[model samples]
Target chain A: MTRALLIGNSHVGPYLNALKHAEGEVALDLDCIAAFGDGLERYTIEDGVFCGNILDPKVTGRKGKGPFPGSEVRAVLKDYDVVLLTGLRFSIFQVIRVFRDLGLVTMDSSRDYATAAENGVTLVSEALLHRLIAERLSGSLMMQIARDIRAATDAPILVLAQPRPTRQVLVEGTRFETFCNAEERGEGDFVSKTYERLAQELCAGIAAHYVPQPPGTIDGGMFTDTSYMMGTLRPPFWKKNGRPVDFRHGNARYGARMLKHVARELETL
Target chain B: MKNPYSDLPPKAFWKTGVVQTDKVHWPELFVPKFTISANSAVATAGSCFAQRIRQALADEEMPILDVEPAPAAVEGDLAREFGYGLHSARYGNIYTPRQLLELLQDMQKDAVHKALIWERDGRYVDMLRPNVEPDGCASVKEVLELRKQHLARLRELFETVDVFVFTLGLTEAWIHAPTGRCLPVAPGVIAGEYDPKLYRFHNFTHSELLKDLKAIRVLLRDIRKGVKIILTTSPVPITATASGDHALNASTYTKSTLRSVAGEMAMKFKDVDYFPGYEIVTTWARENPAYEANQRSIRPEVVAHVMAVFLDAYGLRKTGAADQAEPAKIHDDAEYLEGHDDDLVCEEILIEALQK
Candidate 1:
């Protein structure tokens, strides 16, 4: 029996079913170890151990640091034949900070910038900003994590570059407001370029496969929390009142597409 | 020497309600003396109609220098939405020479000035936008300086170009409120918040268009001396109009003005010619067939035919016809596959053909 470990952020949700479909088509035994949360918390994976809150409707409630410890990552990975590491969405704060540091954004006042920094927005030297952020959570880090898991499990490591979401869905009033704000500040291209560079760098040393999602394919089910309000909103679009939601996460369709590619890659593996 | 028109019937002869055969005397129309095919590097730009010209030449395997960037990804509508690759082939229309010149000048200037301001969230942000400026120009000096640099770049591009094609797209454009500079599209269409005070519409009259065309011709001559120019009018209707005229009438006026200017320029300039792309698509192709159900854009087959006619006019032929040929495999994978067409009544020959 061959097992495949899957590591990714919220975007990996849709691909779960796709991975299953791929396994059947390719006739490979596969196990997905998907971790989800805010910040580095999503990296925790263990059965029954909570790791971060589930923002998705498919899953319920907040999860603690998991049933499995970070040290147990290698042990759990040991049973898999191959490991796949997907990409992560940038934290909202990270997006805001990057733009603010770059001088691409001026605060409403100097006080706002200082306030944002004091509010746990990591302040680093201007020269080290991009490099520091890149070193910490870039796709390369994910690749290294996959490599470590592979070493422990005696499985081949196959890192998958994060598939870009076809659409950029913005939800107002949610914590995701920072991303939309950054996008408005003309940082959309900057963010995209950074992600592209990260993907390229991740694929450099590793035998990884890059799969791009078809452009403009996002529909309503993906960002279920954000609604198009008729009026009263600044942008006239805001998050609906209810459970906190992460509209930035990819829907099942995105996962389905990635799974197809993953399944095809596994056949050769 | 053989009479080039010897095969043609007399003009007095009537057939199909025409005076004589519409057959062209290829040798007379395209004299060998002027049929030099050099390894020229031509740059094509104009309104959207210019795209058709490029595609037509490309379909015939004719070499033309295309400076546009390749797409970043394969799938989806990015290529179309962003006006790159095949999307440009279908919808690139340059409305005026001034706008085209301005774009070239800006590209040239952008090469040196790499910084660009991106507007996000009601703020301006500095971002790195790649610059591929034309040679020998650092920054735009003035409108006249831009014109001079544009001419220089055109000369450089034409030195290696055997034929230069430009399609005039529109006569109406929005001018910058402060600078009085004409923009490619209205400000609000693509970018920038709509400010009525900051923008005003300028509809160029026939005389104004002619003056611009003359200036462009002089610029072309100053550079390449005798670079051949071909002009066409875009047939696509305007998405919206500030003229307060009905959209149909606006389209007619725009197309008519462009076509008339093109015709006049063709008559006046020795190296200038006009291709009837608008008439070909709107009248010839439109009258022939219905468009595909899903897409209202011109049918692929019609585009192909238009391109073929274009190639024939330029005395160019497709190289490696077999290489360009598409797959002809029939779907006869299995007996089960054949059962799907069970309702069809087939003759013995047809059945034999299918079996074969």
Candidate 2:
């Protein structure tokens, strides 16, 4: 059996919920350690332990709910066959927004960008944009965590994909307007493919591998299908008094789909 | 019975004017015909040393105009590497008066020819301003499109500048054989192959440069009425010369011609003024040796001293920042060299490799 340790922010919720009802062959045993929002990024590996105040919540609050509670996470990293790192605030929406604001048009893009030139916007080449995005990601907390883990153990690292936001965001239009504009302008596929390609390259820099989001769960080129987003986890910060669902994460069924993909990836490795 | 020389001030004599002048009182070195205040809409473009002037002005919170600014995500060293915030726009290192004149003409026409795109290692670069994108563009179409947007921003820049500061760097340049348009760097130095059949090495004469300056003035006033011009000759020498002369003789000839042309233009036009940055760095000082060991780059302390004199003459020094007027104190050679490394982004230095 493969023993895997998963570390991330609230995106770990779906994986935990899926493992509860997982049955049959039991080819993999998974353990999870997570925090709310960017809190997980605060931990530093010290004296063979991932130490931070945020990790204390998972140790004390929900003891018997999950396999291998957060408290033992730091000491057991080397014992696992593989470590999966996911969701330190990286999002496809952020990438789309920066590219749109910079007045970027890919080589394959058919969007009319003549207006961008009239607004005194500078056009960046795809090669330059790729480098800028990589540098931008290099400074993120997820990469920092990856480097910290690599220093601590020799276990193979697998970087998991964050769930794409739901398609409802385009209709709501309260946030991530750039994503909507990109869809209207037909730049959605180029951005999605570019993000996946660069993300794979970044993982390769540390001799790790990247596991992309399950293709079955994605609707348009840039969004999650609505069927996977029902009752997705919402932290207190995102939960309004009467809101019915979290528009950003995926549910247990989506996690089961992602798990199948991850298992097949591990088999090849 | 007093002679004409009897009433002359101490500044009239070389011994008192240069030998005895201290840093604090050195602001009198060059009297300004016009002053730049906090409100002046300043635009800068020139050789690498001109970046020092922009840095000093920006450090003091002066109102310098940047027509093409980097996005908020690019900051610190990354912005400099990408060639943003280097000048009013990213027209990198306008080394010759002819180059500057050509840039202004291109802005007027609002076009950059597709021929300016050159490929290096399967990646295309703007032959006009190659260093702005360190990693070359993916395609020729991309280069032309970016240049189109750059020309539009430059048009906006020309219509709005109040004071234009330009430093004269070199008289030697490589030119396209068919068209006289000067290439910023030698072919193959940054990108493209150097073909003698298609290109020629030209060392501009004093007459040609002076004529270009005249045309530059007319263009500036035509775009914006009463735009003031401050011209300075860069003290930094050319990294390499395509001229047959020895490098030392080539450097001297280039500086002498530039200095003479700048001085003559200042005298001929009312709106044009010359600042003696070349005289300041090349002239001997008792305690401060200006150039670093490389004998090309000027020390940071000297650059600071030169700017102090410039800002004081224009009454643009930050209030209560009197310490900026004093010479930078250096306690040891190691300490001095520690922080004084040349960080100017110069593409001309690439020619040094060809000689090796």
Candidate 3:
């Protein structure tokens, strides 16, 4: 069986759960090293070796969950032929910062931007975002991981971009989701192209790959379609007041769908 | 037997003018010919130093006209770094009055016929603004398309804006030899390859500077009949010179030429007003030193002082405006160089970096 270490932040949960229930002739054993918040910042290159006490939930909280990803994640990494890295520290907030600084959106232009985003406008072009991050944001987490992993092992790295926020995100209009929608509208391009360009550059930089979101998952060119997002998360989610948390995360079914795409691409690799 | 000096205000002399007390004396800085109201549509474009006022007015919740505003989702940081909120439109930095005039002309043109996209290391750059994009555009077509949209937005900004603020930054510029068009930066550093046959350095003389300033006035007049012009020279000195003289001498000559032209035009026009931003930073703080140790960058305190006097002199106070000026955000010279030293964006500073 081909062992695939799916290393990431919270996005790894669905993929791991999906592969667990999945039954197929496909020879892939999944392992994960997941953390939330600034967990990734701990895994630094110390004395020219790559390792971290990656299981400490107190330091990098698992959101009040039991049975954390095994402590042998770094050991498992060496045996895996491939590494799936998802959501390494980049946020939609960076997009908001870029958009605001560029004056693409003004104080009075919010409604127009929101409407445009609702209609599938991504304000920052994929090319522009790619170039900005590739050139200016080298200190980004993905960049660091790419460099460190390239140094540590012979196994190839495949970066899965963070999934698009759900349709409810746009419809409900939370501050974060609203910004994401506006970012999409203002950019005005196929949202997946951002992941592709970043992947292309990273691959060129470190001989790895960037796997874009499956084409069908994105609807109206900007957001993740509801079909892909429905009932995906486990333990569901909620606040202390018993209100359901408005997470943009998807379910194991969503991950199962994503896994099919990843398996197809791995055939060529 | 009253002498002419006897009747003059306290601001007339050096000792009684600014140095008599520790308290900030704002009476002498500016006496406006026309007041700026809260809803006044102010359009701003200039050298890097002009960004301070652009940001300050923005802070005061004044209506600074932004014709080509970024999509509303674009918050302050993104808008700031990528040429959005830096000026009235995304034209990057207009370092000189001539460049401003050229832009206004481009806006009026039915078709911007020859779009210049420079190529360096197989990537395309919008020659009009080489520094705006982090890397470069995908193609010449992309560059042309963005420039066309920029001009369209700029045309709108010029039309509706009641007040136009343009800062004069430099006298020296690289221009296309045939068309006399000003290049924001010298060729060969960021995008275009340098060709002596195609390009030449032109240190605009006082007459040339005045003519450009007057041409801008005329263009603004023709575009919007009642548009008022407020001129200021960027107090940030010419950090480096391509003129083959010492940087100190080049800066002195450049500042002198631009200042003289501004003074002459302000005196010559009914609508034009000259704010003492240059004097406030350079001459007024002779003892306290407005400039950093490098003598190139204007200190943050000085920037604060200049803008404070500016708002007090011109800013319209609504019912509950903040009375006291907040502590100014400071960017030292090293800090400015590492990140967005926007004032120097359009200038030919990159060439010096290339040499070393």
Candidate 4:
């Protein structure tokens, strides 16, 4: 069994669930550690050890689950065969910021921003993607996180593109519908593809394996299917945008799908 | 013989005023009609050169009023590329007063127009200031919605800013024929079809420049009680011209007309002040070919001198006597001189891409 430190923000939840339901005896022992928002902003590198956040007894962790690790927990990364450095979902929003800058949308209103991204498309393969993201890799937390772990442990690092946010229709006039209304084939696909492509290139530059999001997870476009996200999430922004879209974390089924992809890729490696 | 020169201050003689040793220092280069104190909120508009003022103000830690600032997480050149923190609002590169005035009108909310959006490759571009968003908006609704907030912010700027540093970059402009809306880049440069019927080119004469400046003055009259104007003509030459004349000859006509108009406006209005930024840069570049080899991009050191002189004359930063000893080079804005992120997006640069 390959001991893997499945470390990231809320995305770790689905991955953990994926482990519990893996086919036959899954050959991966997962240890998850994460904080939400800038929750780990307090963490620091003290001496040779990553230290801090987990030290705080009061941090309501990813989804208010208790006891996510501090910087010191990075020590355990040495024991793992592959360290999965994942997200606080920074890449998606960064892509949103880029589109907003490009003036492709009139409003930074979440609905308009989301609609633009959900509908935008770009035809980029890994080499082209790597070129686009190579310059920006160091600037992202995922790469920084992996680099920091590399400084302490020689474990191979693998990264995943932030799983697509829930695109469910919990409400009749949700913002996703606003995005759907605005969607075209190429332009809408461009936005999500930009993030995935950027993430893949960034991970590769850091010598980390870039595990793409599970196939069929994205429904013939940039969006994750509402089916994968339906039960495993809580919709914080639900009903406000006239849809209960959990634009952040995904459910267990989504995690299992992500893990299956990662395992399949690892087997090939 | 008490001619104007004989009785004038020492600064009147070239040897004393500008040329020789003990030449009048940065502050004496042009006495500011109004002081821009450290905290005074400043707004910059018009031309690519105007962006230098915003950056210098930010470097000085002066309160540059950027209402459409890129979000905090979007830092450095990437933020700049997105067209954030370029001006007081997201009104990107107001290359002429007409464009500036159009933005002011758009801010009125009622004056917002639907016809300004330009399309290329199935994407909608905000023709008014096209470069700010390179990819164009996904939908017309997105464009309008983004513009509504942008206009709201522009309206707020009149109330917020103490100084408006407006640089006149060009006399030649392309506008929508029927609507007369000023397009930032000539259509087909950034993203638009150059339709002869819909788009018409006009090289503004001195009268047109004066009339447009006065129009801006009239609009400013009602907006805020005491907004100071520091008008300057950009020393950066136009990259290409549609005028039948040589681009160099066209550049002379553009700069001269803008200078004359600026001088006229300053003379006509008490609040409007014309700074000799044009003379400073052009003269310095003549003495030392301070432009890049292409003769289009002004060397970063030249930009440094412009900022240093301006800062010494008006704001909190004053050039030291030793510093002014080299009056030809205002070296205070060293980061700009370092030229790290100075590959500014000049619409004129797009002329190379235009099908010649």
Interface RMSD of each: 17.3, 2.2, 7.0, 10.1
Ranking of all predicted structures according to lDDT, beginning with the best and ending with the worst: 2, 4, 3, 1
List where candidate 4 sits over 4 angstroms from the true fold.
A1-269, B1-4, B21-27, B284-287, B318-341, B353-356
The residue-by-residue lDDT of candidate 3 on A25-69, one tens digit each, is: 346787676665446666765543445446455654564322245
- I-RMSD for candidate 2: 2.2
DockQ for all candidate structures vs. native = 0.02, 0.50, 0.13, 0.12
Q: Give the candidate order by descending DockQ.
A: 2, 3, 4, 1
For model 1, what is the C-alpha lDDT against the true structure? 0.46
Scored by TM-score, the top model is: 2
Candidates' C-alpha lDDT: 0.46, 0.78, 0.67, 0.67
| After superposition, candidate 3 runs with Cα above 4 Å error | A1-4, A7-29, A32-83, A86-126, A132-157, A160-190, A203-208, A211-269, B18-26, B72-79, B244-246, B315-347
Best by lDDT: 2
lDDT of 2 by residue, A21-75 (tens): 6864446687767766666655778765664336344565743233223423444
Q: Give the CA lDDT, 0 to 100, for residue A238 in model 2.
A: 39
Which of candidates 1 and 2 reaches a greater DockQ? 2
TM for candidate 3 is 0.73
Residues B131-217 of candidate 2 have per-residue lDDT tens digits of 998888877777777777788788788899999999999999988776767988999888889999978999999999999999999
Order the candidates by TM-score, highest first.
2, 3, 4, 1
The segments of candidate 2 whose C-alpha lies over 4 angstroms from its true place after superposition are A24-26, A46-73, A107-113, A118-121, A171-173, A236-243, B319-340, B353-355
